[model samples]
Target chain A: MRKKGSYRIKDIAIMSGVSTGTVDRIIHNRGKVSEEARIKVEEVLKKVDYRPNIVASALASKKTYKFVMLIPAFSKGDYWEIVNQGIERAEEELSGYHIEIERVFFDQYDKDSFDKQMEILEGMEFHGIVIATLFKDSVLRFTTRLDKMQIPYVLIDAFIENTHCLAYYGTNSFNSGYIAAKLMYQQIGPDDKLAVFRFIRKGDSCSTQVLKREEGFRTYLDENHFRGTIYPVHIHADDNEGNRNILDSFFLLHGDVKAGIIFNSRVHVLGDYFKARKKKDFKLIGYDILDENVAYLNNGLVTHLIAQRPEVQGVNCVRDLFRHLILKEKVKKMNFMPIDILIKENISYYNNYI
Target chain B: MRKKGSYRIKDIAIMSGVSTGTVDRIIHNRGKVSEEARIKVEEVLKKVDYRPNIVASALASKKTYKFVMLIPAFSKGDYWEIVNQGIERAEEELSGYHIEIERVFFDQYDKDSFDKQMEILEGMEFHGIVIATLFKDSVLRFTTRLDKMQIPYVLIDAFIENTHCLAYYGTNSFNSGYIAAKLMYQQIGPDDKLAVFRFIRKGDSCSTQVLKREEGFRTYLDENHFRGTIYPVHIHADDNEGNRNILDSFFLLHGDVKAGIIFNSRVHVLGDYFKARKKKDFKLIGYDILDENVAYLNNGLVTHLIAQRPEVQGVNCVRDLFRHLILKEKVKKMNFMPIDILIKENISYYNNYI
Candidate 1:
């Protein structure tokens, strides 16, 4: 019949027949307190499940801290823009706690932009940072410096191994890829030909998510012993002539492919290519829900989409990072974002804010 | 570069060139402030977007509230049990704010049990209640009394219309059904035979979600001009002989049925029947993710599931009701939950808490 509640320090003091100072000292493990008084205070605390109110504590200590977000420079209506909106939401929610968040973006297609941003971050004074690990080598080096400075950091979008990350908030790339294959189980048979299409710009950026997703997809097919020929094609992004040459070669060679998967957020590029040719009956699956992808999905150009909840991921990364910085709370290290399977039928019901 | 935040009352008063008491009175719409003072305060409030801090105000009031959850009696591993867990989560989150939740259950299959529970509820002194609107007539009548009593209530699982409820938290049943039919578009063609299955016990409980889902499902097929015949069947629940007879007749008549839909959480029962028969090529879509249903899903009996986020609905229902009651805030009437599409591959990614 009792509620899951905590008693106030005053209540604990009265119950333990001790002064509030002794209880406070015991609770904080600071100053000094007698062993008998500590045991009595500990007993009362245990009995009442004495969890201090986070909101009150946050307001009581008016110490201000700064956190920075290291992400890709994005235009409006892009995936990074959506992530920025979510970060803004978290910033608003934590405004009363005096936690300031500064967003710093680097060009995802250029390693020089990453180095430039990292140089700026090196001189900035911040308590914590959230990174979208686009450039693996640059980010790892920066994280090493962060570890030396004792600054906690969170990784989003993708992660690096052997780095001291406070937590990682993103989709499990391998599982998402495996699930993409699973979605095609009812449609594509064993003898059907499958393709993996990836669009990339020239850069030394980390390809962890891309490689992991495709690996998972192939692993599923291999594990199921799918009796089909699989094809993988890489197209140059944002280079019209280069992409055209690459894609023309792919279509001429693998036009008979029954199904395909795009490992990145630009499934729309494939949709655009197919739209011009009026392609039909070719099942296409990909990642994220850009508006172009939704239009393609509705028109049946794209069969299904696996959304990584970019906004949701951004909100959690900042919120949990703040919890650790301000309240000294322990956060789970690997907080995987949900992999939402979206079709034209169920897309309206998928909530990114959840 | 400014954050989305509000200004303090002191700052507002100083800006308006008035006393803090005058600003407070103007803000509260009380104590007959002068026209000039009111104008100044109003202008400053609008300019500064003076939203009062919910947490600070909540702590200052130090008032307590009692919210009652009137739901179906739940076993340890049932759908209702999952909803209960969500309610407990919300209850614990609000514990620091002095809000207490009391759970009251009623038999879902018996009208008399509902009546008795309603009588007990009517006699209790509660700030608010969250109801699982199972029985339409009885619930509507009770809502009328609640309106007169000026006590707010929220409807979960399903809702009854024409009532002054504070809010309704559940999936939009029609959209869920329409989406269910959409899931079958790739598998079941226009010429495939489909069946709608229902299990019921003798009672006057309202079947809003069931009827709406079926209606939506049919609407999709009808809109598409499906050439297949859809057979609807009802089996008596908890009556072994009656269910056996009904199912036997159904199997004798429609042994070649290619697809089926269950409008409730008992898809596992159908899975159980098909298990022994080793039925293949029959696509069965149903609701919820009970352990039994998940087992069948993993074994390939249940093809896909559309989940209503039952626990998420419960948590929101209670939390929003508390906000409306204690914070003097306005709440939206209809909060439709996301309709998550689940398969064996992506089931682990579904988060009820979010």
Candidate 2:
């Protein structure tokens, strides 16, 4: 017998009359060993001085991996820049491994734009794909193609439950909205009416976040036994004319609506519209950052901004992809980055995330 | 010629008259080739097209790594439990790469305990070590020995400025304390007297964190134009009787003392002493999560707890160690996790990290 804490797997292997692979398999409890062989191996292992040399083993066997990521480009108010920042952080930290990333960015708004991007991607081979698709039709079509090809992929920022995906990373849009509703409920009394404004681009189908957020907002009110009326309105995201008309119609209809919730990034437009009209104060909650949103956030027009660390989602997705592709590691199927509640006090610290 | 977007690196390599390794090196800019060779390879790569096959590459190279972790054990009432939780999380996520972690825990308060642990560790070979040391002299000695032996190491939750550590993961102690003092200065007036309380175990080394925090707290007071007597006190962490006498004497001597700050985790004892005597409120700031401190926080006796995600530190340290051992990656010499300000409203969220 060796001295205290001085034993190796080679000794165990020699004693057991087994190969090192067989010994390792037994140690890690990998399946497919004969009962007789396993018993013999275990009997010898109990007597011998044996421990795995982890560092040398890792160095000798370290393999390289590669992953491919395809997502919407951060253009025209796309919040992908923050997500890219998150990806970069993960990349810089994980650069030592053989894991590499290939990225393709598609336009956010147009369906044909996705098709054009897909045309460029069909021939490129990859272990996995990470995508944030705004339109259901395009997402389904692309996902189906991947499924048929048997390529593993993760969805970031948004997820489609119907598709076969390896994993997802994003905030639960509905839960965030529900939480926001609860926050408003605490400050506003039973007599107040709440309105939800959704600014969606015309024909933009990746409104899953908006729809889920709206559901969560209403669910909070319903669950809390609140007797407040909730009004939801959808306006063209970038159309000032449509936004103005919807705002006018909603205010004219309610006249007493005290608090408002804007689902998605167009909270800025609502803030701008209100600021232009010079309304002093109306408790408002919104999603994402635009120049308009920050202005409202600072001026106290936007009471809370439900920030989903977009950059973190981006960074984490890439990190997970690296793990899956390079390490042949099992990545978590559903990775939910926290729903950060941002007020003016905490907003400055979080300004650089995305 | 193949259809658009239908070609891969294999086709490019075949046309380029170069090995796939050469092609990969060119793509990554690893730069070992002559200019003429590089130009020729690029010319052929452009002609034939080169898309990466991410999956085949991952599957082909099935590498596993071994990491060795040497950390401080959770002594009775020690907050290192939170740090262990972080390490476990990183391990769970890293299991896919066949990355196995062998952990050895040493007592923080005893030098002989660490020596005994290190003696056992030297016989058992490892690629890297991640440690949180409280006994600075022994630790620095061990670190130097490890460096001489050519083993990589990462330090967390402390600052040993002169050492050549592979990485340091924790708070920017001085800045964190300075920020805390600035926050306190906002509430306390210029005429008010402030007291600084440092709770330390008898015979413990005066750590960089403690010194830096004290320096920062004092600097803030000086810079803010506060004209008041600032008294500093260091008391035995476990000596309740001695601590009480010092506390009572300080209060009696300076009855006009308006605020106090605890540099370490000794606020619990102070909070308890005050509670026993029925003093409910004090503008107090302390560090870490001891049950006594939490009670004071809930009751509003302690104004704030400067939380430095201990769990995150543990997790990141192990992760860094893994990268060094398994992936052959170089880690940063210093990694400062953000200093989080914990208040009553956000204390519940701390459970996630723990």
What RMSD value applies to candidate 2? 10.0
lDDT per residue for candidate 2 within B210-311, as digits (tens), equals 778888878877887878888887677568899889888888888788788887766777788778878765688888876667778878888778766677
Give model 1's TM-score versus the native structure: 0.86
Q: How well does candidate 1 score on lDDT at residue B351?
A: 71
Clashing pairs in 2: A65-A326, A82-A311, A82-A354, A83-A311, A86-A315, A87-A315, A127-B55, A134-A206
In model 1, what is the error at residue B52, expressed in angstroms? 3.8
List, residue by residue over A1-354, the lDDT tens digit for candidate 2. Answer: 443223456557787888877877888789677787788888976665444554334324556455667776775455777677677777676654445577787766566777778778888777777888566677788899999998887888766789878888877777777877866776677767878776555354646766787788888788878887777777774589877988888888877888888777767777887888777667888877655677689888888777766776777777676666555568778766556566554455443212
Q: Which has the greatest lDDT?
A: 1
TM-scores for all predictions: 0.86, 0.54
What does candidate 1's lDDT look like per residue over A1-354, in tens digits? Answer: 234455667878899999998888887779989989988888877887877667667866768889999998987767788888889878888776788888998887787888899999989999999999877788899999999999999999876789989999888889898989888766798988888887665675546788788888888988887998888787876766676677778878877787888888888888887777777878999888888888888888999999878888788889988889887899989877778888887777677525
The ten-residue window of minimal lDDT in model 1 chain A covers A1-10
Q: Can you list each candidate's DockQ?
A: 0.51, 0.05
